[model samples]
Target: MYRSVGLMAWKAVRALAMSMTVVSGVSGCAAVQPASRTAGAALGLDAYYTQSVGWAPCEEGKTGEWFAETLAGVECGQVRAPLDYRNVQPDGSSGAQTVLLAVARRPAAEEKTGTLLAISGGPGQTGLDLIEAAYPPEVLAHFDIVAYDPRGVGRSTPLIQCAGGLDPDLDLNADDTEALEAAERTEVAACVTDTGLDVLRHTGSDEATNDVDLLRAVLGEERINLLAYSYGTQIAAMCALRFPANYRAAILDGVVDIAERPNDMRLGQERGYQATFTRVASFCVGEYRRDGAECPLGTDPAAAEEIFQQLLRDADARPVPVRGGSPVKATDVLDASYTGLLWPSAWKPYLAALQALRHGDGTAVRRLADFQDSEGTNALTAITCTDTAGPDHRSHSQTARRRS
Candidate 1:
C-alpha cells in the first residue's frame, strides 16, 4: 500500500518537475529583489518580511556538528518571526515576542533557476540535516536548495525541553492510566516551564506554515518549489491552501492525510507497522531456508508474529537487560522496529537485531531504540498535541481498554 502511494507521489513530482523546467526555460533566471517595505507594510508584516538575513559559514557549535560535516559550503542564517502572528503589533514593535529560526541554503551549482524549500518530517527534525542527507547534485545545480528549523525545533530559539528528557522505560502495554496521565502532566509542565506556554501554544502546523511564508518573503522569491516529507506534508498542504500564490509547485512525499482524525491516523500507523513486520518475518524465514540456516522467527508467518508478541510480553514482564545501560522495554523494541522499517537499508540489520533479542542479546535493539529516541526533547509531542484540537480522552480510554 505504501509502495503504490510512493509510486504515485513520484509520478506527480516528475510531472510537476517537467512543467517547472519549461516555465523556468521560458521565463529565464533573474536576480530577485527583496520584497519592498511598502509591500510588506500592506500585510502588516513589514518587520518580519523586510528583515535582513546575514548568511555566513555555519559556526562550529552553534548550528550543530552534523551541519558542518554534511552541508559543507552551505550558508546558515537566522530569521526572527513573531511568537504569535495573530498578536503582532502591526508596526513590528517590541509588543510581540519573537523566535529566531535557523535557516540554511546551498547555492545553485549552475545558474539559479529558482528556490526550492525543503521541509523535513518529525516536526522536530532539522531541515538542514534533511537537505544534506537527501538532496542530490542535480537538484543543487538547478535551484538554490533552502531549509529551515521550524520554531521550537533544532537551532531555533526557545527550544522545547523536558527535565531529564522523556522516560525511556515507559511500558506502553501497561494499563495504569493514572500513572500515564501523571507522567504526561509532569512532562507538559516541564515543557511549559522551560519553553514558555506562549511558544508551545503557537508551535502548531498553522504557525509553522506562516513561518514558511515568512521565509519565502525573506528569500525575496515570488514563489517557491516545495519538497516535503511525512509530517511536513501537513504543513505543506496548509501552506498551499492558505497561501496559494506563494508556491509555484509542491511535491509531498510520504504524504500524510491531514483530514483524518489524529487518533485514527495513529491506529492506521500501528496496523501498517504490524503488516510490515509480518512481511519481514516471512522474508526472514524464506531467506534463512535458502541459506540452510534456521530463522529465529520460524517458518510460519502467524507463528512468527506470535513469537514477536511473546518477546514484547516478556520484555514488559521483565525488561531486556543491556550490558552498559538500562533495560529495554517493550516500547523500546516497538520504537526501534518502527524506526528501522522507515529505511530500507536498515531492514537486514533490523532482522538481525530481532534474532539477537530472541537469543537474549538486546544490545543491537537497544542501540536502534536509542537512535530513534535521540532527540531527547518533547518538541514532537508539543507540536503534535498543540495542532490536534479537542481532548483525546476517548482514544486514550479505548487504547487502555484494549491493552488491558
Candidate 2:
C-alpha cells in the first residue's frame, strides 16, 4: 500500500495489475496446484503434539520429573529470524527477531489428509491468540493446526513496541495537542531499530510470501492449505501469486485490495461507511416508527440523522468527560465510530450512543470511548507502520475530515 522505492513501486503495481486480471478473469475458480510437494515425513508426525516443546514421553518407571512437567498437550516454540530476511541463513539460528509458533494435533479424519495453516489479519494481530480461540478447528480434525506469530509482532522476540508501549489508554487521539504530538513520536521504525527502514523497505508482500513458504517448508507440509482474514488476505494472495505450487486450497475474508494505496484505501473506507449508514437508516426506519410519537428523538429518520451529524460536530469542538480524568475528543469519536461500524452487530449500540449524545448526554459517548481506549500490544503500531509507513499528521487529519 505504501511504496518505499522505485523497484517496490513497480513490483506492487505489477502485482496489482495481475490481481485485477485474476479478479476479473478467474476469481472463484479452482486453485492452481503446486509443482512439487515436500518430500519426507512431516514434523511431529511420529506422535501427536502433547507438550510445549518436543520431548520424548516419560516411561512408567522414570524418576525424571523435568520431562513430566515439560510435557503438555501440544508443542510450542520460537523461531529466531533475521530482522532482514534477504541476508538470512536457513541454518543460522541467531535472529534479531523471533517468530513464535504453537502447534496442536488432532486425530486425522479417516478420509481427510493434509495440514492446514491459519494466518490472522491486522498484519499486527496475534495469530496465536486467535488460534487459541478455536480457529482452524475444521482443519484441525483432519490436519494438524499450525499457527505462528509474525516477526515484530506478538510474543515474538525483539517485539515491536509503539510509543510508550501501545498502552491504549495513552489516548491515541488525545485532545491535548502536546499529548497527540508526543504519541506520534513512537514511529514504527524508531522503535524496532534492528529492523530499520532498510529492512522495512524490503518487507513487502514478496517477503511475506517467502516467509510463508519458509514456514511451510519447516512444517514439512507437502502442500499448505491456508485460511486467512483481513490483511491476512494480502499474505494469502501473495502466496498464491508467488508460490502457487505450494498451495493446496485457501479461504480469505475481509480482503484488502493490495493494488490500492493506503490513502485510497482510507477514501474507499469512507465510501463504505457512507453506504453502511444509508443501509442502517433503511433497516431501522421502521423500528423508529413503531416506537410511536413518544420516541426519544422522533419517528423520522431525518431527526436521528441530524443528531448523529451534530454530535460528531460537537465532539470536534469539545471533548466529553470520561473516567481516569480523560476526555473524548473528535479523534476518539472517529476511532469509536470506525471500530463499531466495522461490524453490523455493533451498529445499533453505536447508533444509540449517537442519539444519546445528540440529546446532550455524554454517557454513551464516554462508555464507548472508554472501551476504545483500552490498551493493546504494541505489535499493531509496529507491523502497520512498518508495512506502510503511514500518513503524516496533516494527511491523517485530512482522512478524518473525509470520513466525517
Candidate 3:
C-alpha cells in the first residue's frame, strides 16, 4: 500500500525537455569545520556525526553507470553512519561498522537558510534526483537543497540486492496467509543466500534517521528542514522525534498523518482507497471529455466504479492478456490504480488506462505495474521488510483495530 515513488519512474521525467529514459541517477565544508563539531556535540553524537564531507563533481556520466546527466548542479559526497548504533563503544568507536549515505547537494542561489533536505519516501529511496525534478529555482534559492541515498539503496556503496528478485504474485486476500508467508519466505531466503542478512538487520529506520543526524552534522547545520514524500514522512517524523532540536522544519506530502503511518498500512490503505477512487471516478465520468467523444465511463460515476472493481475481480479470477507482454492480473490493475491515485497529474493517464482495460488491453496497466517491480526493487523489498512488520501481523487484535 505504501508504494515507493522513487522506484515508480512514473513520468517521462525530462528536465527542460531533456528526456531521461533510463539514465539513472552530495556534500561540504568549513567555517564549516569547527561549527560542524559544535553541532554534533550539541546533538550528543560522535566525530562521524561531526565528520567533514569531501564534496566533488558527481560521477554523472563519468564513472558510476548509475548517475544521470540531467540532474544539473548536483554535488556528491559520502558520509559514514554506524551499522550498529546499539553497540557503540564508550569512546565512540561505532565507525567500525560504518556504511555510507550518499549525498547530493545544490547550493542556494545567494544567501542560505541552512540545508533543506529533500528526503524521498521509501525504506529504499534515492532522493538526489528528486531535488531538481520536484523543486523549482525559487525554492532552491531559499536554502541549499540536499538529497541522499540511504544505506542499502541506490548509489550507496555495497548496495544490498535480493538474489531471487521481488515477488509480484503476492495475494492480497484477507484469508491468504499461505500465499503471503510463501512470498516472504522466498524473499527472505534470497537476501540471506545472496547477501549477509546482518547488513539488512541494521537497515531499519533507527539507523536511517540517525544517518540524518550524521548528515545534519556534516552540513554544519544545527537543525535541518525536511521535505518528505510518502514514506519519507516516516523518516522525517522520526528525525524530529529522535532529535527534536535538530529538525528545524518539515513539509510532508502523501500519507501525511503520523498516526496513519505504516503499521497496518495496507489495511489502513484499503479503508480509504475506495473513497478516494470514487471521487476520481465521479470527476472523470462527469467532466472528462476527449475528441468531442462521450466520457469514457459515460455519465454514471457509480457504474464506472463498479466497472473498475469488476475488472480487478476478473483479473483475480483469470489474468488479462497484454498485447506483447505478461498478463495483467488483479494485483497489476490494483497497482496501476494505486500508482495513479498518488498524484492528480496522473489522472489523465489513469483514464487512458481504464479505457485500455475496457478494451481488454493490459498495456497501460502493465506499464504502471512495471514501476512496482522494476529492475532494482530488491533493495526496496529488503529495506521495507526490514523496516516494518507485516500488516497482517497486526490484523488480528483489538489493539491493532484501535490503532487503525
Candidate 4:
C-alpha cells in the first residue's frame, strides 16, 4: 500500500489494525448460510447465490502468463450472476439472462480465518491483478485472497467494448462543449452497440454488491472480509451498507466519496491533481539539488507551475512527436502527469519523462498516457455514467460556479 501522512492516513491505519485484530482473534466459525435464508431469496436470486464454483488452474492463454506467474498458487473460477437482479425468477432460473463472473483466488498458506475479497479500482480494472501484488504475507497466510472481475470487466461475460475505437487524440482542452458532448455520445453509442444496454444499465454498484454477496455464498463462507481500493471502495462501501451481515470486516483505502455527484467529483479531482503537481514540482527540485543534478522545474518551486504551463502551451502550438504513434498533445501530457502521480515509485520516472518532454521527446509521457487499456475505457465510462442518478447537463463553467 502507498504511504501517506495525515489524519486520513491515521484513520486507514487504525481501520487496518482493527481488521487484522478481528481476523487473528475470531474463532468458532459458523456454518455457511444459504443464500435463500438471506436477502437473495427475496430478490429471487437464489440460483445465482447457490451455484457451485468449479475452480481450476487458470489457462495462461486467457489470464496471460504474467498473471499466472504473479499469482503462482491461484485457482480460477466463475460464478453465475443475473444480468439484471430485478428480473430474476422465483424458482432459481434465469429470468432475463445470466453472466459469468471471472474469479481468481490464492488459498491461505496456513490456518484460514476467512475469505478476503479484494476489489480493484477503475470500475473497469480486473481484480485478478491484486491477488498477490497488493496484500501482505500475513494476509496471504491467514485468508484466501480472492478477486473477481466485476460485471462487464476483464474476462467476465458480456465484456464492455467499443466496436469503433474511441478517438484517442480527442482535443480535451477545447472549449467547445458541443464537440465534447458529441465525442462522449459517440463513445457511449459505440459501447451500447457492442455491449447491449441491458448489461450496461445494470453495471452499477448495486448490482456489483449483489454479485459480491453471491460470491460469498458460492465460496461457502458465512462472511467475507473486504479489501478495496480507489473506485472499488464504492463497491465495498455498498456491500457494507446493503449486506452488512455478509461481510466481517472491510478495509477501504483511497476512499471515494460516493455522495458527490459526477461533476462535483470531477472538480474535486482536478483540485487534488493541481495540488499533487505542485508537490511533485517541489520534490523534484529538492531531489535534484540533493543529488547535485540540474532540476528541470528550476530551483524555485513557484516557477515550476509557470514552466509546466508554458510546456502545455508549447505542446498546443506544436504537439510533441512520438516515434511511431500519434503526436502527443497537451492533453496527453496532462493525462500522463496524472497517471504518473498515482504512485511514489513512478515519480522519479515521471520527472525524467517531463524532462524529456521539455526537450521535444514525448515517448515516455505518451507511454504513460497509454497505460489504461482502451477496451476498459468503455466499461469505465458506462459504469460511471449508469451508476450516477441522472445525466449531468451542466457545462464546465456551470459546474465551477456551483462548486464555488
Best by lDDT: 4
My TM-score estimates for the predictions, one after another, are: 0.82, 0.63, 0.78, 0.85
Give stretches of model 2 more than 4 Å off. Answer: 1-82, 89-98, 101-112, 132-146, 165-206, 283-304, 348-381, 388-404
- Across 1-404, the per-residue lDDT of candidate 1 in tens digits comes to 01112444445444443456322211222233333323322345777887889888775446554364645678888899888777776566757788898898888888777788878777676666655644445556767878788888878887877665445565555799988887778777778787777677777786788888888888878777777777887777777766655677677776667677666777876787778777777777887457775566778877987888888888778887788987777888887887677655577778778778877878888988876343434777777667764546321111110000
Candidate 4 regions with alpha-carbon error over 4 angstroms: 1-43, 59-68, 288-294, 389-404
Cα lDDT tens digits, model 3, 1-404, are 22233322322111212321112110121112223323433322475666788877676433244364635566777887777666566677534567877787887776675567777765566666665655544455656878878777877755776766446655565477887777778877887677676687777665777778778878888766666676777677776666655655555555334455454676666666777788777768656663353454657776876677777787778777797899998878877877777666677788788678767888888888775444246766766666554436422111111111
Winner of 3 and 4 under TM-score: 4
Query: What overall lDDT goes with each candidate model?
Result: 0.69, 0.50, 0.63, 0.71
Off by over 4 Å in 1: 1-17, 21-42, 59-61, 64-68, 164-166, 286-296, 299-302, 374-377, 389-404
Of models 2 and 4, which has the larger lDDT? Answer: 4
Off by more than 4 A, model 3: 1-45, 59-64, 90-95, 174-176, 255-264, 290-296, 313-318, 374-377, 388-404
Worst 10 residues of 2 by lDDT: 395-404
Model 4, 196-243: lDDT tens per residue? 877777776768878888888888776777777778777777766677
Write down the lDDT that model 1 would get.
0.69
The alpha-carbon lDDT assigned to residue 21 of candidate 2 equals: 21
Worst 10 residues of 1 by lDDT: 395-404
Ranked candidates (TM-score, high to low): 4, 1, 3, 2
